[model samples]
Target: MSYTIPFPRTALLAALGVACLAAGGARADAVPAAQRPVGEVTMSVGPVTRTTAQGLPEMVRRGTPILPGDRLDTADGGHLHIRFIDGALVSIRPGSRMLVEDYKYDPQRVSASLVRFKLEYGVARAISGAAAEGARERFRLNTPLVAIGVRGTDFVVRAGELTTRAAVNQGAIVMAPFGADCTAQALGPCGSSSAKLLSADMGQLQVEFRPQLAQPEIKPLQGAVFATNSTPENGSTVVAARSVAAAPAPAAPALGRTDSERLATAALADGAVTAAISGQAAAPVPPPAVTPPPVVITPPPEPPPVVAVPEPTIPLPPPVLAWGRWAGVAAGDGDIALPRAEAADGRSVTVGNAQYNLYRASDGQTELARGLGSYQFALDKSAAQYSLAGSVSPATVEQGRLLLDFGNARFATDLRVANALTGAVGISGAGAIRGDGIFFDRSVAGQAIAGAAALDGKSAGYFFEKAVGAGTLSGITLWSRP
Candidate 1:
């Protein structure tokens, strides 16, 4: 005689889910060696698939490895949640296709990390991780018409061929159209008068970009606007006929276990995997208690005398260009999008870096007057990069001082690049100042540092690119007279 045991419907479905995930892991060996795993699918529902870098397509389930250059596609009602190696999270909505353009993360040198994603079509939500926080300047998400840059952000994007929509869940983003001023080749955010700056403080407002326009328009985010469609082909439309999947059922505790723990037990019979999805670590078990012996207290040490040192004060000569970093903005976001240069008190009417209207401000009218003092580097407002063959990490800049002699019509600057990988690399350059306030490195192997002073004489800035072995070290600085 043979006996058959009955299984619950929910348990049966969970078992199948577990088996599908296991199969996905087993196929990992087929991926090429050069294409390493950048993330993993922690949760997947319905018809989800991934197209590999080599153009291989397969069904994706929970536990599937997400490789660089992989394209993820979801059918109607399909959903996917991924956790990247650097702790970033991405949620792909139904009827969506997202491509992981590039992802490079090094735990030891997170500043060198680069993360890029392209939302081919549909909607996706992204949460910044260590890679983004460590090197916000290197993170980018591209759409058909616009490129989005972030400074430690959590955001959502809906992409279409003609239009792109972006909303910030946390932090802020700089959205710019791909044109002569902003290009795909550049990393980090681009700033232009037409660029749109969106932050969570703006409430439920979303930035909408169109291929035909240079500036992005703002719109309210209605609940129905982002809903998934019952019909897969109509998913991208604003109106929704029906929901593809039902909302998850409320949890009912079986024991004293949490909802996640209960689901982990039912799904894979393991809680470790659930921890990754929830972004929570398991609580450590306390050690066994033991009786303590008598303790003896020690006497406190004597305190040392304190002395206050006065800070040095320097007098300002005259106003030329008032050099100051944009208040309340991170250095990674680059320059603020100023509509026009502001002229004040006979100073240079505009202030910006190489990427801005500053280059155009040299219209033969503004002149650099002879000044005695030097402009000091604002370390807090400056940023540098140390680029090796396979990496570009942040470098500490110190001893930054630019000496200017308008009487001699010359300028010189020296700063040290303290890089963990290459140690400290000294950089020193000098060049003749031109009548138009423009200057170029005259030192041999010139152009080590090329920059200009504001015609108003209030501010100055330069761009540096120096070769170090097989790699190059580069950075930009904003200076003010001291």
Candidate 2:
């Protein structure tokens, strides 16, 4: 028997059917590939793996296409290099995790391209591509505490559990606190209206974040050790604004020896000889002793002996080695950043490689070193190396310090304790090196000495002997000239 449903029941059933249809329609409209692939893995070494947006995980291999929302994880010794369609390159180091949050590039319509990256942990190096050059302000990298805006430059970034660090190799980058829309043109909420711009000079710009601090701190990349206080204290929320001023031009060179000698000869001929001869020659023409003006020879009060003031001494420049590219590495337990006390269980370590183009200006006083290289680390049984490049202009050899720049990185050490040999060199001091997505602070007595020289004129050596708690956590580095 047919029965008519109540009006309310009929209406509810109709409503449910409509809702189902709407949900089905929404599902059909969702296109997974619409976002497009931003880049592909060009190089993968050791144990690199990735997790796709579909929640599927697999080992990463060369040529693997990477899309937004994909997460990459590198194990000890694992290294991954990605080249985006827009020509950007990113190198991921070992024991690190990163995510390609979003990336869109349209060669024809460059203005609409966008790039976004999330560094969950570990280190990575990035070289700006078309997106940075075309859509200069649309690229962003997010870390635990900061968001970095790209400005068509190269840079390195490291994200740790308690801290985040960034170094600019070529070009420049702007950083702001998390959740802030920091851009190359705008500082957003994290920066004051008068925030200073950070740019790359002969040294790399460094920005660091601490949990207890409200804003990040900026400084030149000086490789020195930083002491952490374990005591819990109230956190401060004040952010300091800073900018790097342009360096002054080098001073003019001192007068050449040839020029000084010529001037001296002229002076002697013009006055010294003439005066001496006149005094020695008798009053020949007694010149009409005219006035013989009385014995006015009362000899005015004897004038005090003219006291001559000594001229200030100008320091001579230190003897410098040849100006060209020198490549090497510093490896040892001290290369590890962890405190020795905390590293009870042995932690894996790897080597680092560096190249420097040491140059001296005609002034004999001005010197500089432009460097580029990579650091490999093996932590938790995973190994990987990240790329880095920078320069240290005017690398002066002064009484107090020796500063070295590697594009977006820098190193500063005490010159007093540094020794240079034909094929080997050693430096020890309370110094630090920042850049290449890493921050290292050497202890007061920490020393880095390399002695072994290869037949190719390269040096393979170790660094760090007095690291606080990094038990045997050292680094090995190879320096090459090519």
Candidate 3:
């Protein structure tokens, strides 16, 4: 079975009404319901405190509901995890302060869902939940110098004094400079400019904020050491110019005077000042010298090249997949294959644009019962597959499981299983389930399982599989309940 909680508009309005009355105002009914609790703390370790809108700080316990306007501060060793109603998981690392600025979730009503957070300091990891996937551009993370927009993936963000670093573990994120709307000459209303899109395969990026710089400097993060002093000016011009120019003709360092010479000069200037103050005659200073203009000499133009050079070669574009369709093959004995059957009605979930069909099967062949409905499958751009963690319904096969592995030219499936009583499990076999009607050249051996889960009462077998390879599975019945 599957379910979705509707947005509590009345409760939110009532809360606003109470707040307005407490503030000695009668316009509580005019307040919007956007500032409401959209999630709660599912896990907490050590001392995690939350400051309420009333300016009161309180310790956060497990299952504590978090609302908009709530400020969360974690102690040095404290950790916190917030699970939003839309299934997004946010893990707050130690010594971090975060604010749930605004959140709205209504799966049935896409326009009503939005999520936004502000990380004042410290680190936080966000796994895009159902709400984020559906809301798309409406989801964002605000930092000191930039605002990040998610694309249904897991990502880590670290906020610091000098820079903000974002690493995509899965999917991609777009980051734009904060308050970029105002003209560089005038700091006024906040606006947006072009954003930088970062992919997980490209590692991480560090956004360095500098004084007098209109835009933040973004560079590939090398290691733990962040380039704080690196700016656009230094990166493209100053540093490159210095590297290319010949070593300054071996001239003496500028202003290389001795301490004695400096002291004597200071003393003479002091004496002159004293004489001028006293209206008396002082030593006459030497007049400045006139600089001589250099005589110009014209040089002969270089002779034409003796030999003609061949034109440079233009590289060809990479080969693209045709993405044609193929019919399923019947499995002989010992061969693995999905049974030919229509998906059970009402047993599926849609996350973003992908819908998963849950199914239950016995011995990987005998269909038992299909799940009541489909569950959302959030796409992980980094892995190029749907995330299985925290999935509402995961397919079951024999004593093992069928896992999806998507890539550029192959759609591979792996059989993984574990003992329920002893907790012993391992991946038994893997192969390319579909491709360009050819044996997948890529090695399937040694491919690690992205994730796995046990088949429980709440677990269902069915999920929407988005094709990443040379084929399309888009809405096909990969697995389903009886």
> Candidate 3 residues 308-371, lDDT tens each?
7899999983211111111244222322222323222212111111122122222222121233
Clashes of each: 9, 46, 26
Model 1 collision count: 9
RMSD, each candidate, Å? 31.7, 24.0, 29.2
What candidate 2 gets wrong by more than 4 Å, as runs, is: 1-35, 179-196, 202-204, 223-482
What is the descending TM-score order? Answer: 1, 2, 3
lDDT of 2 by residue, 116-160 (tens): 788987878887878778987678777776777766677777777
Per-residue accuracy of model 1 over 421-469 as CA lDDT, tens digit each:
7789888888787665666562434124666776655567666666777
Candidate 3 matches the true fold with a TM-score of 0.38
Residue 203 deviation, candidate 2, in Å?
A: 2.0
- What Cα-based lDDT does every candidate model obtain? 0.68, 0.49, 0.48
TM-score per candidate, in order? 0.43, 0.39, 0.38
Q: What local lDDT does model 3 show for residue 149? A: 78
> Model 1: which residue pairs collide?
320-456, 320-457, 320-458, 321-456, 321-457, 321-458, 321-459, 347-456, 348-456
What ranking of all candidate models by lDDT puts the best one first?
1, 2, 3
